[model samples]
Target: MEAERLRVRKDNSLLRKREPIPFTRESNYSTPVRPPDNDELPGEKKGLPWPVLLFLVTLVVPWILPIGPLRLSAYRIVLVVMVLPCLFMWLTGKVGRIRLTDIVVLSFCVWVFLSLIMVNGLSSSIEPSGIMFIETFGSYLLARCYIRGPDDFYNTVRALFLTNLFLFPFSLIEFVLGYNILHDMFSAILPTFNYPPMAARLGLSRVQSVFDHPILFGIFTGSTLALVHLVLGHGDNIARRFTRTAIVGTLAMMSLSGGPIQALAAQVFIIAWDSALKFLKSRWQIFLSLLALATIATEILAKRSLLEIMIATFTFDPLSYWFRRLIWSYGWASVLNHPFFGVGLERWERPDWMPPSIDNIWLYYAVHHGLPAAGLLLLAVAFAIWAACSAKALDSRLCAYRMGFIATLMAFFLTGWTVHYWGAAHCLFLFLMGSGAWMLERKANTGIELKTDTIKRIPSSHQRPSPHRNAFTRRILSETKLQISRKELPVLNPKGKVADLLP
Candidate 1:
């Protein structure tokens, strides 16, 4: 008996690759992306995505080499290599239409360059700013390019889960021993940053595993908990979901950081809230409204600002929260002083007793670069989240997937207030945020209908090609007076005729 081969009748956006069946073009012709030869490439590209590659590089290879004023890390090396291709993908519209977030991120990069140049000499600042460009925009674009849809998002989350699962035992051993074997082993043979081991809190020592710090290790592993349960957990047995969650959560707890705990608590709270209010379609809106109202109420009623109160409430240590409050006050004051271009790498003026380290990533950008630079980055994130929230998913799977991505991001938004992400964690955060780019483009309906041969035509892929590569698609859309998707589309039925491809 022969095995039955399943063929996809209609194209799905979630399908990793649905190469447009080639059509004859009387005008400028274009080729498909990386045309498969010798039948090696099949339904989907099986290798890890570039973003996952970055993720793995961060986890596996923390090798750092001192380069002049900066220390080079493995993930940054990957970004430096990937930035050009990433830019090419964005410009060619391979990912999707450019959203406000895309424009904001680009503007943020330029703003960072200008801020750096103003504070330091152009020669001195250009390299660091360019490095920032690679770290922020490059990582963002890489996620956008590879994680195209819900399926990719699920796979990415699965990869994270499995990786964390593998690291679980090691993290446990590291916690018990008060030493990170992986970090110790890596530092032995490779160039690694020296971070003194954190003090043991509550009889257990911090477990950093392979990352630079305990908080980093904790947050990186913990943030994926929501992504796992919400995306990959759907339609699966509760046992499996619990197992995966337990693995990730326990590993995160091994680091024994308050930020991870708070993030996990937030994830659980959202999950429970959704479960309780699943009947209401407007539940999320209600939650957001209440949250907003609470913020205003807190601002008016509480002695501390809402941010300060939230940080204090969420933090495990009251002392840490107080320290951060001081940082916030002093930090914003300095940001006000250098409102245009900030103090650059140079330390901001403060009372001699206050430690030099800025714990908040949001505040770090403002203090080190400028308020505008930080604002642009914040706006970009907000826009990305809003884009995801506003768009309609084509299916329930996509809906759940969006929830997972958003939940993880929410965790990061809160976690970032207490701890500043640096090195691999920083790159990972941007990459994860950028992975939601596809959500920005998805819609429940294309609003396209086909009645007969005279029906409108739209591109299947989301690439809005240039004149030469996709001239045929452009001409067809122009003639038919139809909207185009993000991918490059072709006129399947030339001579003003198209078979019904839309449902």
Candidate 2:
């Protein structure tokens, strides 16, 4: 009775025991998994963003096309290659995921649209204004993409710099060979301008590159070069640094371009001002000093004898100076007559009481766009100033580039006394616009609190450590087998009694 009771107790205890849990074998080595993000926007789906695309297009296209008198084939190529692609992508909702910069750019564009409509109705001749709107605004839109990052800002300036650098050798060759690339583009008043009558007289000489005219070439080169140095500074790049030095030396030796000289001087003033503003505490004092320096520089440049000496060393074209004087007088006259809007865009002729400037940028602005349009241009300048200041507030490298670009723009504005400077006028100005937009974009991305609309956590693939276990569980089957092998009971009996497995 006692043995049966003990057996029953053991059976009950065995029955109440919990079943063993399964164990998975694991090694020390593990390969990490980095899953792809599905939430990426359409624009970022592929390589190369939108802004760079636009910059290359506007810059290159106008140089290629055969629009009326302007055979802008090369320029057209740039537009086709760079700008159109970006515009197409943007229109198709493939780039720019509704950025704040887009909104800002769009707002300014809307203003231009309104101005275009107003000018189309108000102008005496509608064609010029209409053409101007299409070309200028299109250029603006294309250039707008470059304003997003410091890399873009620097790269755009670098590209502009290289284009001019490449044009320099061709210009020198054109001067030597007397083969005018822009011959068909212009109605040349003087064919023998390059071959002077006596003693290789370099006076009143203009050197044309592949551009529309010699003066246009000088203006474009001077303006672009100024912009390059203004934004980029005299850096260590072998190609650019050497190219700039050579061009400046050659221009100085030739002394044919007045616009470039004035531009260079103005650029110096701007650089000095930039340096001063950073170190000097008093803002008004800096401005006063800048004004004084600029006036002094102008007065010094005005002396004909000194000008001749300066140009004799490098040979800057003298025709640009006379051209500038004529334009300045005309610009002042236009300002006096119709100070408000000046003429209206591309309205070169005088309106009854209004006087007209030959090729003054300010005059161009006042006449073509009127005061409001001009104000918008000023706003553009203000935006550029804001961008420069803002860039200065960030890291030092960006600050240097921003300062250089700002100074370059200022130089161009000051040099606007001379040739029409259409290329430099728009390109450099638009560059600043892009830079400003870039800064704003950067600032917004970092500073502004972007609220998350939704949250979803994907599983991370990090392996968690296994829980602790006793060694006895691992050897349970082996121990059970050993006990069965050492049995101490009979295998079979008449009474049919079960035997113990262990001794």
Best by TM-score: 1
* lDDT digits (tens) for residues 1-503 of candidate 2: 69657755764554445543222222111212111221122123343235454454334222333557544443344443555655675566553444444444444445545555564554443445434443454455565543445555555666655666655654565566554444433324222123222212353335654444444555455544544554455435768655664564364323355556666666656656666667666764668687677667756786544333333333343563554455555665655665544444545543445444455555566555455545555566555556556542344445566566666666556555444555533543554454444444333112111122222222243122111111322232232222222332112112223323232
For model 2, the superposed segments whose C-alpha errors exceed 4 Å read: 1-127, 181-205, 224-255, 272-357, 423-432, 443-503
TM-score of every prediction relative to native: 0.78, 0.56
RMSD of candidate 1 to the truth, in angstroms, is 11.2
Writing each residue's lDDT as its tens digit, candidate 1 over 252-284 gives 888777888878988888888887998999998
For candidate 1, report its TM-score: 0.78
